[model samples]
Target chain A: MSNNNYVKNLIESGMRIDNRKFDEFREIEIKTNIIDRAEGSSIIKIGNTQIIVGVKLSVGEPFPDTPDEGILIVNAEFSPAASPSFEAGPPDENAIELARVVDRAIRESHCIDLKKLCIVPKEKVWNINIDIQVIDFDGNLIDAACMGTVAALKTTKIPKYENDEVDYEHREGELPLVDLPIYVTIYKIGDKLFVDPTKEEEEAADARISIATIQDGKICAIQKGGTGYFTISEIERAIEMSIIIGENLRNLFKH
Target chain B: MKEKEKLIINRKRLDGRDLYEMRKIEIQINPIKNSMGSAMFKFGKTWAIAATHGPRAAYPKWQQNPEFSILKTRYMMLPFSTWERSKPGISRRSIEISKVVNDALSNVIFLEDYPKTMIDVFIDIIEADASTRCAALNAASIALALAGVPLKDIVSSCSVGKIDGEIVLDIAGFEDNYGEVDCAVAMIPHEEKVLLLQMDGIVTKEEFKKMIMLAKEGCLKVYESQKTAIKQAFTNIIDIE
Candidate 1:
């Protein structure tokens, strides 16, 4: 089937190939503490697609531009084994895009208080690496990766350090660095927008937009993808929907 | 060094379980509502979740045997599951286990009942210990059962190994590293049929037989525990008096 025909059929049915409405999402399942070695880790399943996010922390010099603040690096990789289209070696455009979308959502929202991450001013600060891996590609990998990243961050705890020597005791006293920042992605297929597109919808999608919002209805980041275009009104509608979706997602992490 | 000498010297294990004992096993089913079936299985420090989806229609143009169903399995471990950071992906080890699990499950699933349909079983390991793969397979089986997938029988799995040259029922991280032999077995308790078996390291045929027998015994125990978990889950939904 040609790509154009696929899109036409999908829009006409008001459903993606997987039978999900444009506003509907593939079933989502989130599991935290899936990674024991990382400070925080989570796995998000959106339909058959799976993404695992792990957060690791290290003490390092802060970036020159933000010397007083800590650093947050988001790296995303799509394993060649995940799908036939993903090749080995450096990240492809899709993987890079996934990382940028997730990173922008979290970083732009200032999910973690960078100042708190700083321990010795410019000399040493916490470098939080959020690594996302696409384990399976059934569809909508970016949304799943972002959700897992936020959940992992929310569940993450930094160890208390005083004199560089490790102290296993007195663990609970140190608080987490920041509140949770949630991400919601909406895909435009035909004339409608879907909350979370499955793999099939993703393949047939004309355009996709992701919005990252903090708790107070503030928009932190926005990303637009695909060869398709959306009108200004469509963009506004997506942002409104994202806020509602983001708030509900935020509540999910609270539990 | 003599085998008996090695066994006598190492009296204490890392986690302190007895040689013949198994790790504490905790199984939770339907932790998530959206999936057809979902389960979290913990064996001591190791943890994993399994989600089952569909007897949904198979994709067009894929290999289809009209008389049987297709079972697809994916096993993955999160980077945080280990002491060292791991990249998220389907590693070779996980892929091998996926194949084994698919093979094991096919034996018990009444595939002919769901012709031209597909069942996708996904197992994600959140924490890692020595026997994560076996735990994943067991958890997947339980999740499938909870999902109410038609099956000839429910399956359970366990591992046994020779640690310090002594036959141990289940080997944790420390023991797994120093152990001389490792064997994992998946079985259908009611049928007393072994569906999958894997072993590594060195052991005589006699020892292999013993290890397999012990693993089967352990699998039976696991099966009973899984049954109890399933019953509890259903009872929780019964609108109890």
Candidate 2:
């Protein structure tokens, strides 16, 4: 039997290959301040999937449109170390999509107080760059990457800037974060919908949707991926699951 | 922003459209004779042309599948499409859009019939005023059908947004730049299911649901227009014969 059929058969019978509930997530581990050179850094492991995220702050001129707000850039690299499919060149479509989805979650949630990062309106502002590196290949990279990024951002500190120069050694204030946005991705396999699929389950998914929600249960960003279709009821169920799972994930930051 | 002008004044948008009104849409079939199928779709100021090429044998050999054909789509915006000349090359944004558009149309096309083949869809935006992806998909769907490609259902798409505390439909022009939230949706009307969905910006859960419904209504309207254009094209061909 093919992997798709085997996975589908298992899911149809309310069984996942990893033997977890449909909405259950694998064990997650997060460690912060792992990189001394970066302003902030974290490594997150969700099941077998491991990702390292680093946050860097630099002074630069703002974009022409939103000059008064600080800039937030997200980039993701799927290193060859993580999987045999990955290459050592520029980012691929999946990497680009991963970065953009995480970017939308952060930007749309209004989590970071961008205006507060502005040093000189329209002229100079602090640019926050979040770089996500995949160290292990597994399923649910989107959720893992988002969690790694948020944890890294939470630990980021602003470096001291004086006399048109940045003094990296004298870091002072923390990143102006007012809210936390948690991302949840649900995969639809056959007639069932589940969260946190393993790598094998991901290969069998017919469709998937990633949603980002804030503390108030307000949706900030959504991306429906894959070639399969979904009914309205399925979409609604996905939203409900995301909100419930997002709340649980947010509690991880209470410490 | 306190002193900034409102996007909607007395329920009228900047382009004289109401809260749920869509801009005028026009579609022309087989605009490029050299290709297997081609179409031009316009939504007010935004224009997209799509060309469908062969179920030709897949190149590089390794990319071909023994069981089914592969579908590839490329979406590009001309340098002069925007106010500021966009750089002439593929950007990450275009790459992502292409992938989504490909996926949106993938299930609808009957790829199993053509083994070891590839169907290529090229969409170019000659003009842009937001919602370019929706317009491009509309054109591609029609072009594929005209090219003798079998499809289960036609795909239609539209976008809705939140601006000035009100959910509105068919967001265009300056509304995209100033809107608080934007949601684009594509649907297969016959199947009664959504094929594509994407959103950015902020909105309450209630408003998000409203946006999806409103965008669906807008897509149905586009579907009506597509039906008329396709019928007219066939009628023209019959008259010629």
Candidate 3:
């Protein structure tokens, strides 16, 4: 449509409504322990987008195959208050995609030492439940959620086990967090790339790629979304942008 | 009885309130400006919001009833609403609560007026400790009013329970979890008629009678606040205009 062409033309002219460069992120803010009941929690805001991540630790049996390691469950829910488009029922595909992408980044990057989370081997293990609640929606929900989850896990304090029983209210020690992995997403719009696209820009984008980089600057997870292709040179350029952007994001957490 | 010390101690509830004390209740009308009518209701730490839309049209035409408009209600809780990160979906508990709330609200609403149309009640818990369904029903009633729906009288809900061998008004999350015999009651004001009642755990018949009486007394207070919230909403509309 003519509207799409107008947006594309604006992007091609190196102009953004927000008056920022193509590879720039929105102003981000992060805070921890806003939720009173949860042991570990963080709230992240990227531009107008807001996400709160709460980490709950429970004692339960480990999986049969991975008996020695603890379990990590990540779930995301798009609250109806965040946007009019999101319904009040169960989480839909967008929520699921956000959860899976962030989960994959944390799980595959060897970020949290799951083995260290075990209590009595197979008999007892700590079950970590990381829940992402979309408080407000503007754009770039996945990146904000990922930051919140990581910051929350970093601040997580494991419950004390006394006499082989776990106490839910009492906190004992910090979680075994090994490496910090940062999530960076880049969108291709009208033969150009942009970082942290706003909601309107995202709707205009042809395709987007997300990369997760760990402490050592190595790519850990990669996901490509939307129905657009990228050339080899573009992919390399995106990777370079991710590395630099990821390092800045990594410094937000306590080293 | 799962954990006595966690709920009651020396005849006092965990939050250090008397047996008949209710958690702090707050009701703010029309929080979701995009919806026709909306309200955010809270009891102690638990919070839920209700947004009502439609009275527009019924989809597909087959499900429409000629005699009355339909009310489609969904009671949902956020994943971070609970301390232990509740699952992100409509659980059996939520489904049952939706039905119970819908039934309670249906009793007072003038549904027959909006023929071939439907109104949606979307109640989402932003936080949770206990008695979310009751709060949801209370908020939904206010939401319907904001939607300008016809009603006999606005409904209000509260929960009364027997804890430490004593009947109490408005049991909180920990009390409901560890206490015995939680009875959720929804009532129409002034007439003092019961609209919905569900008993969890067990109570003797004599104790049940006392609990209902206690719940009615609590419901009257809830009804007062519901009226106050609606008035405040009206005041806000005037201020906006």
- Model-by-model DockQ, in order: 0.01, 0.79, 0.01
- Worst-scoring 10-residue span by lDDT in model 1 chain B: B1-10
Q: lDDT per residue, candidate 2, B156-227, as tens digits?
A: 999889988899998896998888988888997545588899998888777877888888788888888887
lDDT of 3 at A61: 96
**What is the per-residue lDDT of model 2 for residues A228-251, given as tens digits with 9 covering 90 to 100?**
988766888899999999999999
Tell me the TM-score of candidate 3's A chain: 0.96
Where does model 3 exceed 4 Å of error? A1-5, B1-241
Highest TM-score model number? 2
CA lDDT, candidate 1, residue A109: 62
In model 2, pairs of residues that clash are none
Candidate with top DockQ is: 2
Better of 2 and 3 by TM-score: 2
Winner on lDDT (1 vs 3) = 3
Which 10-residue window of candidate 3 chain A scores lowest in summed lDDT? Answer: A224-233
Docking class of 3: incorrect
Q: Per-residue alpha-carbon lDDT of model 1 for A23-78, expressed as tens digits? A: 66667789987866777889988788888899877778887657878788888899
